[model samples]
Target: MQTEKIVNHIVSWLNNYATNAKVNGFVVGISGGIDSAVTSTLCAKTGLDVLCVEMPIHQAESHVSRGQEHIQFLKETYPNVRATIANLTPVFEAFKKEVLMEGKQDIVDMVLANTRARLRMTTLYYYAGLEKLLVAGTGNKVEDFGVGFYTKYGDGGVDLSPIADLMKSEVYALGEYLNVAKSIMKAAPSDGLFGDTRSDEDQIGASYPELEWAMMMNDAGKQETDFEGRNQEVFKIFKRFNNANKHKMNPIPICEIPNKFK
Candidate 1:
């Protein structure tokens, strides 16, 4: 579909879903990144009430400034838009105390990263439930259905990703089509876990676009994808993340009863 039509289609789909759901509004987390910018804008187009949240916890000044830029853009563009600021530092510390009690202090960075995500999720769901809104996700196709490049119970546990079918490149293109800010369109994608210029590439070792390209080749190019050459460096990264996070992409295990006994 054309970019305009695609944007309209997404907005329409969400609006219809919300109307049928009889919800109060739509809630989304804006991380000063492209995905959330595109999502909140799309939701605004449908005349639906949009809540854009900026969750910056102990971030540097630049982080706060960038998030404000996104918020400013959205406000200038939409009347029904409101960007809410929710800090998660205290919550992080409280939980850290509980973890120290357990004696497993290793992997603090990784654990804290995931903790931030889950905490954000809890806050979002609370607002979602109170407002009866659908929690719109910012995940792209590469991350959602492929390598699952998101925190499992945190960012990964979203209600719906409007851009789930679009690739990273396509997401930028649509952002342009929607007149999103240039800085936002060009900003590096991140989960803002550590505020250390982290990205999917830094965490997963391979960029999202490369992973999707690999998947495309595997689907269409047949056995050649298994052949040597193409960014072999990324192959290992993609496979490793996929394997390690299988549980996140799977259903809860229920042992099958082979016998018919009650």
Candidate 2:
């Protein structure tokens, strides 16, 4: 689709979904990443009331600053965009202290990181309920489906996912077309769940482009060598992450029993 069409389509989708669902507006967690920036911008374009909340849990100052900057842009450019900052560091610290055990730093770290996502999820819903809004998710195709790189019931719990079909590159293109801040478009993507700053590539084992390529190959029923005709490392990492996180991607399975109605 053309850039203008893509923007119009997404904006229409947002508006139509809200209208059909009988919701008042959208609730988006602005994480200062390109995905959130693009998603929030699209939400703002719908001309519905949008609450962009920046929930930081001991995240980098750069992350918070960028979030605030994007919120400012939204407010200035769109009349319906509203934003606020929610500090979640103390809440995370309390959970850490309550759950920490002896000789389990690694386990605690992983659990705590996921807790950050869930905390933000809870916070978003809290505001959504107050305003009769839907939680608009920020995940793109590769992370949300190909690698399942989202915390279940955390960032994964949302009323709508407008960009779940777009690849990371597609998202970047949309971000640029939407006139999102260049700093956000250029900055490394991160979840900001960990206290220490780590890009998404650092944690995901492969970059978004590589993951997207691997997904394309996988969907085409091609072997690892089929991806760019040589490099299988990317495909290998993609499979590892996808297989391990399949539970997040697939809907819960249910058993069936035979009936005698025939």
Q: Distance (Å) between predicted and true CA of 256, model 2?
A: 4.8
Instruction: Please give, for residues 75-148, the per-residue lDDT of candidate 2 as tens digits.
Output: 99999999888889898888878874666887767777888999999999999999999999999999998999
Q: Which candidate number would show the highest lDDT if scored against the true structure? A: 2
| Residues 39-152, model 1: lDDT tens digits | 888888877788888777666555567668877887888898876878888878888788754436547677787888888888888878877788898888777767877888
Worst 10 residues of 2 by lDDT: 222-231
Q: How far is candidate 2 from the true structure (C-alpha RMSD, Å)?
A: 2.3
Clashes of 2: 0
lDDT of 2 at 109: 76
Model 2 clashing residue pairs (backbone): none
Off by over 4 Å in 2: 225-230, 255-262
